[model samples]
Target: MLSGFKLLACLLFSGQTPTENLPAQDFDEYQCSGNVEIDFPGLCALLDMKNIPAVCTKQPASLTTETEEEDTDDNKSLIDDSSIWPKPCLHAELESEDPLSAKNLKISGWRVDEQIVRVLQKMLLSLSKLQSLHFWQAGLTDQMLISLLNTISLCSNLRAVTLEGNPLPERSYHLLLSEDSILTHLSLRNNRIGNEGARLIGSALSTTRSANKNLLSLNLAFNCIGDEGAAHIAKGLRFNCALLFLSLSNNQIGDSGAGHLAATLAEFALTHEEVVERRKLLLERTQDSSLRVSSDQSSVGQLPSVPSSTSLSASKGENKAKKKEASKKEEKPAANKENPKSNKKSPDIKVPQSKGGKQGSKEKLTAQEDKPTTALNEQVEAVEIVNPLLDRLVQYRDGELILPGNTTLSSLNLEGNKITEKSLPLFLTSLEMQGEEGGLLRLCLQRNLFSPDCELYVKIKELMALRDALNKNTSEQTEEEEQGAQC
Candidate 1:
């Protein structure tokens, strides 16, 4: 009976089960052996298999010919209007969950060559929804970095990128931080960026025409930036308003670098270029105001006159009646000269004929109209003249004190650098002067040459702590208000 039962079980289970066939089916599904349209999943599989040629090859013409034949005129028009050719199959099937949507692609420990760059260019162009990209130790050269940055600049949705450990041969890293860049966070740690790179980055941050208005966080730790580089960055910070976090930790910065950075945090006189730009802006405002006033006066003067013939005739008749009454009054004035009370009333009747009252009123009106324009021009001239003298004098305080230095940076990380006790006082004085207006909430000074119990360091820490507490309270209140609004 046992032998019979075993034989029966073997007979029933002779055919392959569904689970047993799954592996073969999956392998065939993933394999891009034939001329099939590659989607996101196929792209991932090809990448895993290191099949670059398969991904870069053009799709079979047979697959698109049928669609082209079936397309209507409107569809053809739309296809012609679209900027991207051979539309990507990312969302071809309208899948609810897209692999590349809001995803981060991290390629580490790989030697990216020209073919890899081509593949990346294609992928980046297609994956418009990709948020962040990280390439760690990818062996990128200067030309490759430039190509990658140019491709990234086209992606409007990508917000953050990390290229740590990929030190380039030249200072092309600043290409990623251009004035029109959309990236909000960037990490170039361990890249060995030096003074030249920092200077380029500073120029990109704030230039003559525009500044980088999008970047919020920058990480430059584990680099070779020194005093000159720090000064360059501080010069940029004098005009930048959007950056909130800067990390210069583990660098070659010293007291001179620290002093430059500290001066940026505190109030300072505007540079020559800044003063010139201010004058230009003031002149522009004055011109705009004068134009607006002139336009208003012209509009008032151009108001429609009474066009109806009946109204014109009525006005003419009234003027004639006034002339006749004036002539009669002139004759009465001579006859009434013998009566003293009558003579006084005759002068009162003829008051409208005198030119003094009308001329005085006209002069007042013209003066009022010219007052604003003259005052504005005078102010602009005053600024242009006084600014030069103020720039020359050492003790001049009457000049405009409105152009404060950088006040938007919230955090600065200088830990593991060569900063010492001598530089600590500059930071402390800057912090104290900033008082309630400083945006710096965190300043990392650890592992520097200064002692932990340094008085200036302690005071700076205390001020930072107070600012942090206040910021926390403000954030909490904002959150509560948002919740209440939702409710």
Candidate 2:
């Protein structure tokens, strides 16, 4: 029989089960002091290896004063009580002078109670350099997930997260993919997510005002999504531009869901709502431009033309001399009598034009000459202005305007669903359309309710193969150019 400390080390390293008859005195000598760098002994002590229970229990809630309650209204209790629990298991890539250099943290096969939650929160906050976090079968609840996601949003460097085999009661997995979240990759496999959760996730992916722009890959496989959920996700795909990979395998989706997804990959006419939205955006942009131009003109006109004191005094003296000269001329009546013809005004007096008047005339002529060019430019700009939130606008045959579907998403995984042969033609047509536009390189349709030798399926695979080859060539060329530049 191994001793308690050695047994715990073996269990942690060898991935073996802990024995039931461990002595209490064996682990009593080892203790944890909340160190940032966690060792096997400290981890075993924190987990209470000597008193291992089949089920983990929640910690008793501590009583707090009214002031403390007010301070913790935003769920700060998880982060504030750092000294109450030991640190979590954090792995660092390289031991360096920097204390917060832990990069990866994986917690597996553990039931996360209140005590473990606090320690995990504290460790996440302390490890500023942590990047990826994986939790497999850690028994996370809805409340725990909410608190954990709230804490994760504050972590700047953390980008990728995986929470597998942890089913929550309320299906609140969409909270991790919020609009402001900075995570780039997320996996929520086997979480029992339903259509309602899928709807919320779609809304988070692309909302009216903003969308999740940081996330690149999302995995929602092994869930309970259906046609309605697929429709909701397709609605989101209409405007989403950042997501590159999406997996919806092993769901309950059927022909309707498959059609909804395939339609989003081809050009379709814009609905009334989208048209109104486009018009509103254009009007707002035009109003902003006009206001900016008016402000610039007003600023130019408000510029102060300051003059020197010497110039002011000289102008006053010149005005006084001119008034005296005018009076002397008025008093010379005899000279006026000698030159009576000077008193008569000329019939045709040629008025000398001022520089300002000449400049104004030239500006008017130039503006009149430029009107045609400005009108042509405005027409060109109007043709080019498309909705930035949605995909591009296209002009179809028969003088109808249409909107192109999502072209940013490169790969879509819908394997092991309930799709039938009826939906194969739809996907094939969509893929052909996408191929013409050089979009949607891959679409997974394996293990579904369709024949492998289906003609439409075969055509789709061929087209995808050709597109993949083209994309590979392009990527290789770009990589070679980058290498040459580095050299």
Best by TM-score: 2
Tell me, what's the RMSD of every candidate? 21.8, 21.4
- Estimate, for each residue in 400-464, the C-alpha lDDT of model 1 and write its tens digit: 22344577898888877889999988898887777675568877787799899988888888878
* Model 2, CA-based lDDT: 0.61
Write one digit per residue (lDDT tens) for candidate 2, span 44-107. 4445555322211111132124324422321232223232322333233322444335555666
Scored against the true structure, residue 263 in model 1 reaches a CA lDDT of 93
The reply for model 1, stretches above 4 Å from the true place, is 1-102, 284-402, 469-487
- Candidate lDDT (C-alpha), each: 0.60, 0.61
Runs of candidate 2 exceeding 4 Å displacement: 1-35, 38-100, 295-391, 394-401, 469-487
Q: For candidate 1, what is the TM-score?
A: 0.58
TM-scores for every candidate against the unseen true structure: 0.58, 0.61
